[model samples]
Target chain A: MSTVSTSIAPAAAPARTSAPADNTSFSVDFSDIGRSFTAKPERGAARGSTVAPRPVLRDVSLTVQPGEVLAILGTSGCGKSTLLRIAGGLDEPSTGSIRIDGSPLNGIDARCAVGFQEPRLLPWRTIADNVALGLPRRIGRAEGKSRVAALLELVGLTSFADHRPRAVSGGMAQRASLARALARNPGVLLLDEPFGALDALTRLKMQDLLLDVHAAAPTTILLVTHDVDEALQLADRIILLGADDDADDMAGGRTGATIVQELVVPGGRPRDRGSAELAELRGRLLAGLGIDRHGQARGVAATHTIPHFPY
Target chain B: MTQTQIPKPGTAAAVRPARRPIRLTSRRGFVIFGGALLPLAILLVWQLSITLGVVSVSQLPSPAMVFLAAIDLYERGQLTLYVAISTQRVLIGFAIGASLGVAAGALVGLSRGANVLLSPTLGAIRAVPSLAWVPLLLLWLGFGEQSKITLVAIGAFFPVYTTVSLALRHVDQHLVEAGRAFGLGGIRLFTAVQLPAVIPSVISGLRLALAQAWLFLVAAELLGASMGLGFLLSESGGNGRIDRIILAIVLLAVIGKITDAVVGIFEKWANKKWA
Candidate 1:
């Protein structure tokens, strides 16, 4: 934890100069957050029938320090994305509140910028214009233009500024999406599987790019991803969300997901992927997600070697 | 390796050099010539039929007779007046109708309350043949430009309204959400996301409304009006002058095609910009 804090300090320092006043990284607090969605009635069901409210997230409480990168790790449908959405104010919690920098979040909080899994770019707009959409309403035209240009440069998409979203490759489009989210200099950036759609090689490159972006902006990041290696790679802290078996039994079965495991990743920015420590943590996280390690845990050498090519 | 590299540019030059120049001028000329082929063939067949005496001259006048009728109308100075009046009415009616369609479509498309309140009644009104509005409009506004233009406007409204509202409603939800997330709402959101997303559909709607405008113009002129192509057709029919009737029809076809071509050009530009 101390190492993590020391590592983030250097990155957070430059963020103050780069980001607008009072718009730098802000702390996020999720206290007793619970969200329930009413299940749609089945077809041919009687009219005016009341349906039970299905809980998706219950009692999800966490406090993220400013400039911290927190990864919410969970399997699909485990309400991790829901938690991130609640923090971004894109979705409201049924119970409890989310406070950003000590202020309670309201509808679509301006302090938070969300990068959705899909690029969600306006198809007609150029990459530059799409990024400009994130500019604050009061920003001057000249300042906004420079900000968009700077963001494109940051994302290494300056050459493709005039290109439409469909004209670019998937990785390039995702980079533009990230740049757009950063255009507002968001106090808290919520990323929901931002690179989930990319090919493996591109995903690795994007993860590195994200680390660089964090170093530059250092906004409080809440990333929700199902990829355990991704969590190990990018997070200062990793929180695993899953159903508590005992609590689930008491609630009659699978009520909602809450924090099941939490770990302070034992390193700074750009941690070594091949480290034995992370391999153990990865095995543990995969187990938490009900995935078998297949004798791949730390200190367990493979009995059979991978065959060489052209063998 | 040297031979491959040397031949690469040779092949590229062979493929590229003539393609652009050909596409620029001669290809376009070829397309235009191809388009005219059918009409020219029809003209030949009509002239041959007349020369062979396949049909009576009184029933289907020779192509020359139709040309003479057009010249007669032009010499009398009525041809320009008729075309001018018809074009003016169609343009004005289309403008008023398309503007209202966009306004109403945006309202209904964006707001649930507006959609619920307006769409049902508008849909019902659209079902009524626009020609049916003529009798009521004549009663309300009398036998004047008001009644005729109103009929054309009615004709132009539905297509634009339907297309605009549907397109706006179906503008990608993800894009709208992203727009909303970035502090855009109301009119800013509309212009930034919703409007541009649906521009192709709106232009298509405008084109359909223009065609409908011409259709309604003829309907209005056929029932009333002292001038215009429809008036010319009806008057010539009454006088048993088939040539004049045929001339009015050819004039209507040419004018309609010209107007549609104008909108088609605009559509091409818009699709390039927005789609």
Candidate 2:
């Protein structure tokens, strides 16, 4: 593993230092984005019975600058993935529009590439072939080949290029999926819990690898994750999404989740995991998600009682 | 020797039996021998029944008599011609039917509009019995190779179409979405994601269609043909040549199995590469 990282270090260096300063990354702007899904009718229910549409996200608006790593943190079913999907053009918002690099986003935008929570690699194709699938259609054969090789090298998957998705471990497959998303050299990278399915140790390593990739390519990244510490460690800014406090009392209780809090993480890339500032922010972010830092609500003093051992 | 000491050459430890590798060819030979046991026993019983006069030779000829019939036909050069014609018809009809099946299947599988427009009619057509079309085919194409080949083609079409379409419909939706997210659509999506995903099912469908081809082949030949195994069976039956009839039946069984085995090889290769 040390040898693998050493090999990747040099490849990432040249792209960062030697490439001309012409920025390839694009800013993403979301204006009043909202999405609603009609509740699926119950099985054997009366035909033509109308089910009310369930609001998932409403009035979400944010702008991510080019080269920024913005983490959208939320609880499950809070539409963080939905927001990322909207940014990548995988899903469209019903109420508002998105613009990438000042241009209105259309269906399946070519300027953005997505890495799903699952690796989502084509099982039949080799890792290299799967990455090559992300190459732009107009790319020349030679350029596409070299681009795929560079991406495999950057992700430390050079040796496993010919292996299929099922033949590799989950971490390796996710790396291949990341390489595939990078192969497009997109202006914006939308990662929806790309490391969520990995083991804890692998997830940490993948987070470092993602930072390395961002440094090398310098593209705007919108990451959706539930891990508060992950957001603290990776993002330059974090946005918390959830339903408002009085959402139930507003307009027949049909209110959807919206941006509740936004904070600019106070540190540079590769922030210390154990730093006091990040720990405080982690506590705050977790509290926003309805989890108490010490298993008790804020503004309450707790008395510690030691367990009496019979021995 | 001490526990840490390495074993020297010719010592008991050094000479201990190495793990034996399983010989694939020998295992395959065992399987083949095992499979042939029942047929050999049947052959033995058949010969014994003739010797014991348990059945009349006119009704059920002995194995030797069937062998003699084969030899008699071989000498006249008609046996080779019959086998060759039957095989040719099956191959041609299978190829045509399978090609049409894939084309129709892909259309129906990929496009919801196409599925809605074509599936009902095709399903109804598939429900018609294999022999039911014989009269209409005869009337349309006459008593020639065309009618026989058409009948066989019709027999081979339905399975391939059904399996291919169903397999395509259930292909991993996540993989399809990933392909779309990477800017693939239409023909590109089908080739890169959908086609390879369904290859195993398509090969299995082909195997079924090949078997169906042979079935329709005999039907076509039995109804009307001058130079095939089915024709030989009918001709022999008309002349009360029980030996020739048994010969034709054996030939048909062997050839059908051979064709199926050929397709089985393809299925194995496809599964390894795609599945």
Q: Candidate 1: what lDDT?
A: 0.86
Docking class of 2: medium
Q: How many clashing pairs in candidate 2?
A: 0
Q: Model 1 compared with the native: what TM-score? A: 0.90
List the pairs of residues colliding in candidate 2. none
Chain A alone, TM-score per model: 0.88, 0.85
lDDT of each: 0.86, 0.85
Going through the candidates in the order shown, the clash numbers are 0, 0
Per-residue lDDT for B165-235 in model 2, tens only? 99999999999999999999989899999999999999999999999999999988988888999999999
* lDDT for each residue of candidate 1 in B1-111, tens digit (9 for 90 to 100): 233322234454445665332343347776798889999999999999989999989889999999998999999999999999999999999999999998999899988
Shares of reference contacts reproduced by the candidates, in order, are 0.73, 0.70
